[model samples]
Target: MPDIALVLLAGAVAGTMNAIGGGGTFVALPALVAAGLPPVAANAASTVALAPGAVASAWVYRRELAPVGETSVSALTAISVTGGALGAVLLLVLPSASFGAAVPWLLAFATLVLAYGRRVSRALSTATGRSAEARMSSRAVLVAQFLLAVYGGYFGGAIGIMLLAVWSIGLGLDTAASNPMRIAQVSAVNLSATALFLVASDALRTPLVVATMLAGGVAGGIAGAHLARRLPARLLRGTILTIAVTMTVLYFLRGTRAG
Candidate 1:
C-alpha cells in the first residue's frame, strides 16, 4: 500500500481513538514515522491532518463545550493557540533527528502523567480543597496551558488527560464540566497549530500525504464522535491507557536498542 494510504488508515484509527478518549496519536505518529517521515515532520503532518477530526468531535459535543463558562477557557484557549503556533515554528527550525530523539522522552513523560493522573488529581483536589490557590490565577494557568500546548502541538499523545487534570484539579473545576472545556481548548490548540503547519515549507511539499490523511481523519472523526456516546467510558479509558503504555514501552525499548 502507498504510504499515504497507510497514513490515512492510521489517521482513521487515531481519529476514532481520539474521539472516544485518547491513544489516537500514539497509533498515528508511529505509523507515520515508520512510513519514512521523520519524527518532527511526522508530528507536524499528523497535527495538520488530524485537526479537522478534533474540530468535528468538538462540534459534535458542542452542547458540552459551548456552555463551559469558566473564566479560564478563553484565556487558556488563546495562550494555547499562541503556544501551538510557536511549536509549529519550532518544528520548522529544529532538526528532525533531534525531534525524533526527544520523542521517546516526551512520550514517556506523558505516560507517567497518565499513569498517575487519577492519584495526582485526587490529591490535588483534596489538598487544595477549593482554596484560593486551587483557583489558579488566570495568567498562571495560561502560562501553563501554553507550555502544555507546546508539547501538544509538537507531539499530541494523551494531552487531553494532562489538560483535564490541570483544569479539574489545579483550576478546581468538576470533571463532568471540565470534560467539554478540555475538548474545546484542545480543539483550539490543534486548529491553530494545524494552520501554522499548513503554511510551513515542508507541509506544502507533501500535499498528497497531508490531504489524504485529513480526509480520512475527518471521516473517521465523525464516526468516532458517534461512537463516543455509545461506548462504555471505562472500556474507552482502558483502551486509551493500554495503547498509551504500549506505545511508551515500544519507544523506550527502541531507544534502548539504539543506545
Candidate 2:
C-alpha cells in the first residue's frame, strides 16, 4: 500500500512534467523499479498509469490539435497504433539481457534530444523558412511519425522532442501548435502499448498500484491543462528537461548495476 502511495506521488510529478514538456516516465519508471517490479513490468505499469494523463492533456490542448488536419491525424494515429503494438510485442518477447543493455543507449539518445532539441528544432525551422528546397512531403512526415511512435511505445523518454522536431521540420508548424499534436499522437501510442502489454503480461495487472497511480495522473493532468494557457513555458520546459536528464542517467546506472 505504501508502495502504491509512492507510485502515485511519482505519477503526480510525472504528470506535471509531461504536461509541461513530456518524458514523465523517467521519474515514474524508476519509482516502479524501486517498488519491486522488473524493468519490463515497470514499463508496462507506467504505460497503464500514464495513459489517461496523456489523453486528458491532449484533450485540453484540443485547439492546437486542430491544425494537424483530420486526414493527417487519422493517418498518424493509425501508424502510431500499429507501431505501438509491435513495440509491445518486442517488450514481451525480447530477452532482458539484450533489452536491458539497450536501455542505457536509448536513454542517452533521448537525453541528448531533450537537452538541446529545441535549439536544433529552431535552427531547422529557421533554415526551412529561408529556403524553398527545405520543404518535406507528407509521406516523409508520416513515416517519421511512425518510427518515432514505435520508439515511444518501446520506451517513452524524450519522445516529445522527436515528435515535435518532425512536425516542425517536416510540416513547417510552429512550436505551440506542434506540441498539442505531439501529445495527441503519443497518447495513441501509449494506449496501444498499454492494451498490448495488458494482453501479454499478467505481472503488470496490479489493482492497487494501477488505480492509485492512474488516478493521481488524472488529477495532475487536470492541473497541467489548467496551467497550459499560462505563459513563460520555456523555463518550465527547461526544468523538466534537467530533471529528465538526471533521472535517465540514474536509471541507466541502475540498469548497469543490475546487469
Candidate 3:
C-alpha cells in the first residue's frame, strides 16, 4: 500500500534486468525490504513477483533459442526446475541469520562474474587452446547447471551472469549464441521457485504489492526484449556491471550495520 509507485517502478526495472542480463533481485529485494518484509519473505516475494517477467523475456527470446551442446533443451529445463524447487525449499528451511550473512558475499561473487565473465572465459579457452566448437559433455553440463539453478533459486541476484560464465568458459560457447539459453534456463529456474513460494509461503498474501510488481514486470520485460536487440553489447554489459557493483556495496554495508 505504501510507496506503491516506487514498488511498481522497481518491479519494472527488475523485469528489464531479467530481459537484458539479470540482477533483478538487486532491485526487487531491496524494494520489498524497504516495504518492511523480513529478508526471507522479501526474497520469496521477489522471486514470485519477478518470475512472470522472466517468462515474458523468454517468450520474446523463443526465436533466438540456440541448441545447448549435447544436452536436450527439455533435459536442461527439467534439471533447472528440479534444482530450483530444491533450492527454494532450502531457502524456506534455512536459518534467516545464515542467509543474511551470506547475501553480501553471494552478491559480490556474482557481480565479479558478471563484470569480467567474458574475459575470464576467453582466457581459459586460450590457455587450454580450446577451439570455438569445444563443449563439455552433457553429463558435466547438466551437473553444473543443476548446481547453478539451486543457487539461483536460493539467492538469485545474478543468476543470468553466472549462467553465461559457465556456458562460455566451460562449454566454449560464444556469448551471443548462449544468451537465449541463459534466458531460457533462468525462466525455468525462477518459475519453479515461484510456483513453490506462491503455494507454500505467505509472501504473496500482500496482493497489492504483488499485483503492481507483476504488472510492471510484464511491461518492462517486453520493452527490454525489444531493446536488447538494438542496444550495444558494451553498453548493456556496462549497465549490468554497474547495477551489480552498486547492489554488492549496498548489501555489504547493510550487513555490516546489522551486525
CA lDDT, every model vs. true structure: 0.70, 0.71, 0.81
Candidate 3, TM-score vs. the true structure?
Answer: 0.89
Q: Write the per-residue lDDT of candidate 2 for residues 133-236, one digit (tens) a residue.
A: 14556666667777877777777766765565455444445555456677788788989999987777854557677777888887777677657557355754
Error of 3 at 10 (Å): 0.9
C-alpha RMSD in Å of predicted model 2 compared with the true structure: 3.2
Candidate 3, which ten residues in sequence have the lowest lDDT sum?
A: 168-177
Residue-by-residue lDDT tens digits, candidate 3, 11-118: 999998878777788899889888767778888999888888888888988988866777888999999999999889998888767766887887787677665666
By lDDT, the best candidate is 3
Better candidate number, 1 or 2, judged by lDDT: 2
For each of the candidates, the C-alpha root-mean-square deviation to the true structure, in angstroms, is 3.2, 3.2, 2.3
Candidate 3, 259: how far from true, in Å? 2.4
Summarize candidate 1's per-residue lDDT along 97-190 as a digit string, tens digits: 5665776776676566555655666676677675534456666677778888886776676677667555544544544345456666777888
Off by over 4 Å in 2: 67-71, 107-133, 168-174, 236-240, 255-259
